[model samples]
Target: MSASCPISRDSESIKKLVDNNIGGVVAKTISITPALVPRPSIAIVDRGLGRFYVLNTVKPGEIRVESTDHLNVRFIYSILNAESWSDISFEHYLEREYPIAIKYCRENNVRFFASIGYKPEELSILGPRVEKIGVDAIEFSTHYIGRDYKPIVDSAKALRESVSIPIFAKISPFTPNISELVRELEKIGVDGIVATNTIGPALSIDVETGLPILGGSYGYGWMSGPALKPLSLAIVAEIARNTKLPVIGVGGIVRGVDVIEYFMVGASAVQLCSIALIEGPGVFKRILSEVEYWLKTHGYSSILDIKGISLKYLKPEPRRTWSTPPVVDEKKCIGCGFCQQVCVYDAVKIDLIGNKRIASIDQTKCYGCGLCTTICPTRAIRFLEQDLFI
Candidate 1:
């Protein structure tokens, strides 16, 4: 069992001790190596109520991890990182370059996370090795295949036993009961939870070709964009409400405002998968600056001041109430009358307002169902809800 490339002579004795207490009947084995240098470490651990901290020392790995105390974290999947690389180069990347990149993150103090697919053993081998090689944290992202989630639960437990580094499990919104999963993760000793990963065997196709735009054999690729904000936010809010484990919210986070939205729902930190690819890392600084400005202007000391403030408003069910109808902004409106066409209630009428023809919505006739707003091509329709009580 010790034959797989021991890091040092002491590793053999360490393996002997670890073997006595097997972490279940796990398939993979990791050769844990002693850290050459003892450095300051920080872990994004759950401090209850879904809050987290970058603490000075973590006891799990015993050897302090060299990481920044900052709560900000970034994630990249090996599949995404290796998409276009040649096999030899990809192998080299898996063996050395990727670990080197993780080392860079550790040295620079950026929280490092590498997300894995369904396989648990991948974490088992890489977790301790990276801890030894110098990455601070690891994340597990899995999609639930069937009703049975035992494999997912077992994988996390196996990794927990195999490595001492903080494990942040990314919750899939597709799961029937995310709160239940959160509790299971808590029991398995997951250091924290990442509120989401992308959903779907979804497809985006060319109109002319009737084939996927993703440009591969498969017609569908994983779908994620600004469209995912609501779904991801719901998961973050649900997990935050149900469990005390800290959440790293993700999905469709294109702006700093989006980050605040996640934090307000109790995400301790966050990750952006798709937007970072589109806008690049410069977005991080821009977001932090925007959040800082917004918080300071509002008399909050820092971003932390606003975190989870919205949790109180997240109810088990949305309040039942009547909303006001959509209003048309004449300045930006093209006077297409698309909204008027779609208004089933006949609440809209076209009129020559000044020189332009515009759609007018009658508040008395409008039920505030807001269907006309959705069909507006000119985006002239504005949907304003009356005050909560109104």
Candidate 2:
């Protein structure tokens, strides 16, 4: 957890998350001084519209995981938040926050990780103090650090020198030469990596007033949620393929299938923040139950059974030179004519089979675009070449 999550801000809030059935928690990123956060700091964007929910009036414990029904993916689900670092001072965390987290996490057998910032001076001060407090590990955020990357490497080196426990570098997706960066961190003795912070200083504006929704200067804020999944998946795969260090995936995870996808691409574990902000602490319990049910039903004893399974399937270039058209399964086709609407090449056609309708592809006109295969409501259209997988 980083900015804007109250659960990571203080001991009491942290306890709520601990009570949920989760194995670990990363405290919000703390700094030397509390941040002067802007008002109206958070906004939820759905399908090109911005919504402001009265989350404060509803107590955290009382809030259910209902808003994120299937991860709020029915629309273009995303969050634009201008939140800064932890509002509480670093000294306060040392005195009260860290101790409370450590105690509760200890009682619950949950691993607690302290996420610190990139200031070299601050790292020198905060790293040892939190380490001495007996945190399982330390995660240093590289979010605010610029594109140069030298400062991040330097700070990681200094932090590695200061702490005895594992040091996880939480890297931003925007960082250049990400694979090279993770290798450098590994060389410097950083223990592991957290792939992807939120994507972009993104923007969302109110159509009614023509004003920015978020309160940050110029109303720019980082975006996190379902929209971040595809980009995060590629980056996590890249980092995992590049380094031996355990990679923890964060960004757009709300379902058990999402966790399974991360593991397939090589995530040792995942962090849920954007979903938690909307779903509250109960989100953890809901997601864990889903994951357990899925694992058991799929006949997997553990997540380790599928870890990094997709890596071996990666091909640098296409194996086939020619494009193959998709086949239509007449039995499964509902004949909704939806596929015909999406086929840009005018390749799909609806035919009346007895009293029912079915979709058929004109192989010559298809051009193997594959749009119909994906857009088909039923599992009717598929590539003939994909039969091997079945």
Candidate 3:
């Protein structure tokens, strides 16, 4: 959440923002009366595009785990790390808002999931409320998953005992060791796990002002966008490798190829945040369409076919096999001596042959990692994989 966003001060604007997000939730989850898009296969967020074109393009998937804002005064105050929520009546506003969203999803025939998040201490109070709301599923998330995460685990276990619906947990990605935490959630039978919540307390600055761009209690705020893709991918990949929990991949996913990459690493599905905010809802159409195109071209029919397929290729270290060395094509070499300077294995040697300065590779010393091939300005080096495999 951006500090300068309208939700901080404007009630109408905040409500409207919430409503749009609800609409996106609906469009993504269920049918809109006349049909919002071509096939209703992709998720078009209500708040992001506010139009039919955007909502119509979501990729077809199941009713995702959803977590609603913990709308109490303290909750709002704390999430933004604001001074207080004195301006908004927590109960009156949420009562007025949540039902309307529920009604919309119900009428639209969408299987909606309601989610809630707050400090772990507030779990007992919110647990009953989560049970009361009539949603298809429940998702529990919190910003506090640091060194002491026992509270989060306890809260999920408590919710599991009472809530009849399928449950999901959204854990923070910042934790150093999440494997054991995931193991505990799996032990208690969490339906799935959203490998992360937004990562931050990150800061973005204006070079001219030498100040932060977002507003918050501190200048720091959470970060979302393609920049987060690597972090999200690592979390999801780690969990997939170690546990059975179904993972919903998120972070910096901006294209159809990214979605496929998430699948290759072992995400059952992916969540869109930055892309939806950046490109609007229409991005779904482009992504899903391209995903379909890629599937067909690759001789695969479903995204599931490629899920975790790349895990087989994952290795802790690169193979150190001796293979063909990068041979400098003397005719093509510009004699820049870039390869000589870059060769970590001390392989490249530049020699003055007759009148011309020429470059050559010492095949004996070249381990075939091929770093020199990429550095060669004249395309004189070839880093072929077949030679490395040999």
Per-candidate TM equals: 0.65, 0.86, 0.63
Cα lDDT of model 3 by residue, 274-383, tens digit: 45444444555666777787787778989899999977767777656556676677776656676888888998889999888888888788877788887765566786
Task: Give the clashing pairs for model 2.
Answer: none
Q: What are the runs in model 1 whose C-alpha is more than 4 Å off?
A: 1-95, 215-217, 321-361, 370-386
In order of lDDT, best first, we have: 2, 3, 1
Candidate 3 segments exceeding 4 Å error: 1-94, 106-111, 321-390
lDDT of 2 by residue, 259-337 (tens): 8899999999898888888888888888887777677777899989999999987668754656578899886676767
Cα lDDT, all candidates = 0.56, 0.80, 0.59
lDDT of 1 at 262: 91
> Residue 169's C-alpha lDDT in candidate 1?
74
Worst 10 residues of 2 by lDDT: 51-60
Which of 1 and 3 is ahead in TM-score? 1
Model 1: per-residue Cα lDDT over 122-233, one tens digit each: 5576566555654456566444456666666877887788778787775566766778877998998998887665565555445697845554336434445566779999
**lDDT (0-100) at residue 339 of candidate 3?**
80
